[model samples]
Target: MPTAEEIRRRIIEHGLSIRDRVIATMPQRYSLMVEQIRSIARSYRGDFDTFLTNLSSIKGLDLLVIYTALLAVLSKHKSLSDEEILKIGDSFDRHIYDVFSASKARRALEEAGVEKEIANDVISGVVKALNLINNKYNSPYLWIAEQRRIERFENSVREVLFRNEGGNRVGRGVKLFLRLFIHDTNIPLAVRIAYTQENKKYILHGDMYTALVTLRSGAFEDVASITAERVKARVAKRLLCEAKEGGARCKDVVMRLESIRGLVRYVGKISGDPIVYERGAYDIGYRYCRDLKCEACPINDVCKRYTFIKLK
Candidate 1:
């Protein structure tokens, strides 16, 4: 088995670009994107939880609905500015969030003083350009889920929402936004960790993987199981915890699955939490690995990807 010292060393070697000084363009771009997202989220000033908690309240979830709907539209396309999204929202139906159809977008654009032909062309151009940019960023759809996952997530979301609130307490806009945003297959593994595991800490995908690797580097079944024993152990552990005085319960709900991924990655890392692997990879890949900047890296000698291919 690897010693505690070895495991700690490996953990330290992880995220070389992030922890080390290897200033590059991609990381700088990601930094700016993060700053912009923080600026945007801070504008909300902590009211999202209230909107989420009270679906049918007097204020209705109008603001949250609008923002998330815009997110649904803008997520795949980053070049489109927040102002453009707001303008599109100005003409949006607020209810027609099912597909975020190009037709709907064109109509909205036309309403926003754009010529009809130009609106169609603009939407087409935006999608094409974003797809091209993403390919450059991380070889096309590095983080997005496959189509099958999307379908399953849509079904799962509908079932869970119906089961939880019986379809009455929740707002339709919330449901639509959730369906698009959480589309089962597309959800990140890190997000599922935070949700199903009910993890109290902000452990990124890499942290979870690091924990597993650290535990399983040697010895059979020392920390991993090849049977149903693991699930049972977790449940038993939880039950035992609940048996304690006052019992253990989730102290705070985690961030929404629908929140901005890049921002989450950036913010989580800055605060010394696990950042999502794919998002972090996107930053590291474009900034350093793609350029083969090992010489500039402080921990290059220990980095696992020291010999990784340098490609765009």
Candidate 2:
């Protein structure tokens, strides 16, 4: 696995000609923010639990104020350009104003005898913090959108497995296999050999090999029985085709597979079939191989699965 520093160095080395420094910094920045958010969420769990319990004790407007404050602090280091900041501020303002302008929220505030001055103060504080472009470098909305997209993709995978009657054990096994394979930074030599000869893409082979090993040990006993040469040839063919056809870009294939892995896991857990899980992976791999366009994969024609692929 590449260390954070190593990843950064690699990015700098490879991205010198990419023009947009922000684009190059995206992966690192996102990693940092995710780590920070996890830390913050863990630290404030007690507060969050209490807030949820005392929901009625706080006004809706007060909750919005707190949310905006958290967003400001969390996004302080995003280093957004002036235009990006303005767009975010505008989104927040419009969203908040629309909520407040609603009949239900307005009526509730009025019934509570809330002072307009207090509401104005809260909104103004949020707006001021949002407008401070210097400290606000991140795109919280984009992060949220990405999260939603991932969730939707996972749901689609689950639906497909459930509809197909794939067995539970196979699905579960495949899901686990996928998770292990997809996010690994190091590519295994065996997987690289298989992928390059068959699929044509240079994937992180280490991850794929680990996944195969796990599959053999766990659900795919038949696969375990298969000769190593046969397995290598099969995988290589699939990967080579995908690479040549532009279904799997060497740069982003790992990330795209990670998303697909998450979907596979979700479906496996829901459907309770190991074969379903394996089939899901094969379907994804094959679909990518057949369609040059990642977005328009042939699997969609028959399998009906949807997933978000991060575009460069």
TM-score of each: 0.29, 0.20
Clashes of each: 2, 30
Give candidate 2's whole-model lDDT: 0.30
lDDT of 1 at 224: 30
Candidate 1 on 81-148: residue-level lDDT in tens? 33554555456544234334566766766775555665655466444534453454331112211112
The reply for model 2, stretches above 4 Å from the true place, is 1-28, 46-211, 219-312
Which residue pairs show collisions in model 1?
Answer: 149-185, 153-184
Q: What is the C-alpha lDDT of each candidate?
A: 0.33, 0.30
Give the Å error, residue 164, model 1. 23
Error of 1 at 85 (Å): 9.6
lDDT of 1: 0.33
